[model samples]
Target: MADPLLVVPVREGTATVSLRLFRTATGDRTAVAFSSPLALARVLGPGQRWIRLSAPALRHMVADLGVTGIVLDPAGTLPPRSPATGHDVHRLRVA
Candidate 1:
């Protein structure tokens, strides 16, 4: 089985960030949890408009999928605020 995909619905305010473990081939979606802005920020990173999920969260998500690696797609979504001057990707390790 392929590694599950983590779908993050990013929006403004204290919106719900759904963490779904989906399998492409089977079209299966497992609702891992619904994370809040503050909670997500604790795991990912700070977002200008939307909340971010930390590296540990990413690692944990991938680990739960029984895979060593998984893709992190922001779903072409961003916060309502204008883009800020900073690095797009944050480097993180799973240990």
Candidate 2:
């Protein structure tokens, strides 16, 4: 059988990162989870941005996927808020 391909950032037209759970005794793939880096980190860390993974998931990912690295993407979809604009504000100023 062919090995599964791994990718980061998960480009729009490409496959997303996948986590394959494995059984310790036989080293077989038992389950798979897929998501964007942001989504995965959100799940792993919950409401907190920086947190350590529980021993179990970390072990499973390492054993099953042979993963040794993770890279954070810098792009974010949400735009920053802009300053309020209106001519009425200037007119409302007191002399």
Candidate 3:
């Protein structure tokens, strides 16, 4: 099976973050930074392989996307607050 695509919310302008997933006209999966949950709902109806990302992994993924100045809550459910930086490539393992 193909590896599941990872979607990280890079920018959260409000108390709740919006999620969006889309396939371009040319058939390429694309996600916009700071998108809306309504848009995500429109795309993801059922049987999608979506998963919540750990804090560390989420930081790494966003950095990979060239985002900066991210602040995660210290008391968040995800552990290991240290952000991973200066890596050319990152790999996420899902079980």
What's each prediction's TM-score?
0.26, 0.19, 0.24
Task: Give the lDDT of residue 30 in candidate 2.
Answer: 32
- The global C-alpha lDDT for each of the candidates, from Candidate 1 onward, is 0.38, 0.29, 0.32
After TM-score superposition, what is the CA distance of residue 17 in candidate 1 from its true location, in Å? 6.5
Tens digits of lDDT, candidate 3, 1-95: 54333333332324744332223334333332213333333333232223445445545554544443233211111111123541212211111
Off by over 4 Å in 1: 1-7, 10-18, 25-51, 74-95
Tell me the deviation in Å of residue 13 in model 2: 31
Report lDDT (Cα) of residue 1, candidate 1.
Answer: 57
- Please give the clash total of every predicted structure, in order: 4, 0, 0
The best candidate by lDDT is 1
Give the Cα error of residue 69 in candidate 2, in Å.
24
Best by TM-score: 1
Whose TM-score is higher: candidate 1's or candidate 3's?
1
TM-score of 2: 0.19
Point out the worst 10-residue segment of candidate 3 by lDDT: 72-81
Which of 1 and 2 is the better model by lDDT? 1
Once fitted onto the true fold, the runs of candidate 2 whose alpha carbons sit more than 4 angstroms away are: 1-29, 46-95
